[model samples]
Target: MSEEPSARGEVLIVTGMSGAGRTTAANALEDHGWYVVDNLPPQMLRPLLELAGRVGSELPRVAAVVDVRGGDLLAELPATAQQLRDANNLRILFLDASDDALVRRFEQVRRPHPLQSAGTILDGIREERRQLQSIREGSDIVVDTTGLNIHQLASRTAELFEEEGAPRHRTTILSFGFKYGLPADADLVADMRFLPNPFWRDDLRALTGESEAVSNYVLAQEGATEFLDAYVQAVTPIIEGYQRENKSHSTIAIGCTGGKHRSVAMSLALAALLERIPGLRVRVRHRDLGRE
Candidate 1:
């Protein structure tokens, strides 16, 4: 899945909670052929994009790490990002984590959180979360790193930005389990529990949704095909609207009791249907497939 890089420069704003693996993400992007700039001020984003545009494919994909390190200047990022979106391919990837995870990381490193000052690390995290609320909302993707190690985070980052020459409207169909909690980054969600569970079938219990037997069982259900057809129909217009609005990415989460069977099968089926929509790039991922 590769093609010539787009002529127009693509810019990614890498931000979010400090110590949430921003540096690791930047390293992964760099290793995978993205030009990465770290600790970049918010105001420099426009100029950087302009430079990439001038250089064309030589600088086709560039990622900038922008965060609270800029102090008061970080306030201008949203407006600057909006201004760059009209003529450029821009996306924001926010890396976030739970307060406890952040505190642990800070303590392990024997360093104070940037905003901690004389207060506790938790205090700094609370303040940072409040300050970043708006930017996080506007971000195209929010990766919660609460349960991920550096290696896992790096792999996840690669899964997202490594693909080359993606369509104008790209979507990730993620299959997850309800018990593990919902994905923080889901733009839309679909529940698959209404259909029969493949886990109940004695023969299918050992197999995953990737197997033909389970996929057939799930898709052969009474309303499965109809639901897939209608859901794809319902989502087409939204993808078009994203194109019109210069938003390049979206995520649709499909869930069931555990993510191993029904949700995975349905997510694959849905991706197959969506692939026919022309100009839309579809990728499927089972988030909780092997979890216990």
Candidate 2:
């Protein structure tokens, strides 16, 4: 470890296992107003920072996406780490998924892992994990995307890196279905199954939670408003403390038997409540809305 960088722009060193949603993360960072260099070699790391320093406020935050594709050049990261430590300005967001997930992704894309020679995909994944172990251990944040959808992974990326004038922390109020399994990254979960299902009603059956009828029906349940009030009261202080602790990303999974009606309504209602809290950003996603 070294002394933190003083008053310099921040740099995000993004790396990890192959097919672990690095592309999604990089894209999200770019969308978050970061100057992103995709697949940049580690040897250029210092030059990039120097360039950013020269540019000053023009580019206050930069994210470099480094991967196995850099081969020998990737070895320069440890040296770069030493230089960045003092500024306390470097953050490595290590994106990783399970071996099974990586294999599936590689197969789906009809591409072989960069480390794979003549061996199986699993062999390449194993080698990549070994090669990345040291850097991963030293990373500032580790995001496991094994069970997250592309949208969810993108949401995580946004949560991790906040733009200037944006909220310091983000809360993703995700609505999911029990049938599709839980969101692997949700920090907290709420079940809405106790409420009456809109799927059973003829008129609401064809409508989503965003529809006024469905929203009204879902909110009219005996304990619906009470739940939102109670949950907001409970989670508000937790997020305040989270921001105080420098934790940036949080997922609150709200679920029902099916994702379309009750959970979606409740997620919207919850988000409505959370939005009133200062400095806390919220995004609502219906994970299984159309799957039904």
Candidate 3:
């Protein structure tokens, strides 16, 4: 069946091991524009998703944190997710870290474990891990944050939901050598260095891809058509797979030897190609595009 216009928004179910940064991630998702609900019961998941779908269409994004705190009812989550899928698109992200990290976080916070009320932190960690194994395995994305600080985690989370500029939902960052031109970061990367160097194209020299003249000159190249054909072939399937999985964001990087000219042109082209995908968000950045 054709996907409903993405239902106008998304529901992200956030769960994972204790002390694995679910709270932090939820906060970051909120910063990136997601409306968040924390520590809701698993039994209420179906009803909540339905309500969110009814209301979230106006909000654009929603996230919830579910974990062992649900007590015995936590086991019912997987089934609840399956049931919700018939009416709404859902993505589950399970966050995890090393046992040592979990223990360290607990000690740092000096809070009693919900499951460890009767035992050591180690015991609590083990039980939580055992109980969560199934959910973790079923997760669409598993983020291991053992070494990531709050900033790094926030950056990663923001990358998933940021909706401006290049393709926001599914981006590919491709790196390549200038001599070989741009790598297949998207469906196409046009090399403009061989063109009447925009850097030397009269009044247009200082303009980057953001300008109409530079864009026109790059698109006017003979190789542009050939590259676009090959690019679309290579990029179409990757994006299709991401869409099938209901991904919210992707980053594809295109790199040339100096990160200028060719890579920039191709990156812009790839961003354009991605725009054709329904509801797919795209974003592009040329890491070395301005470097001398």
- Distance from true location, Cα of 94 in model 3, Å: 0.4
How far is each candidate from the true structure, as Cα RMSD in Å? 13.9, 11.7, 11.0
What order do candidates take by TM-score, descending? 2, 1, 3
**All candidates' TM-scores?**
0.55, 0.56, 0.54
Please write out the lDDT profile of model 1 over residues 37-156, one tens digit for every residue: 999999888778777877887888999999999999888888888877776788999999999999999999999899989999999999999888889999999999999988778768
Q: Which stretches of model 3 miss by more than 4 angstroms?
A: 1-6, 164-292
For residue 15, give model 3's deviation from the true position in Å.
0.5
Least accurate 10 contiguous residues by lDDT in model 3: 184-193
Q: Please, what are the lDDT tens digits per residue for candidate 2 over residues 6-47?
A: 446889999999999998888778766799998998878777
Candidate 3: lDDT of 106? Answer: 93
Separate clash counts for every candidate? 0, 7, 26
Q: Which portions of model 2 show Cα errors greater than 4 Å?
A: 1-6, 164-292
Model 3 lDDT per residue over 80-199, tens place: 777666667688999999989999999999997778878999889999889988888888889999998876676677666555653324565443446545454344343434444456
Q: How accurate locally is residue 69 in candidate 2, as Cα lDDT from 0 to 100? A: 90
Q: Which candidate gets the maximum TM-score versus the true structure?
A: 2
Instruction: Score candidate 3 by TM-score against the native.
Output: 0.54
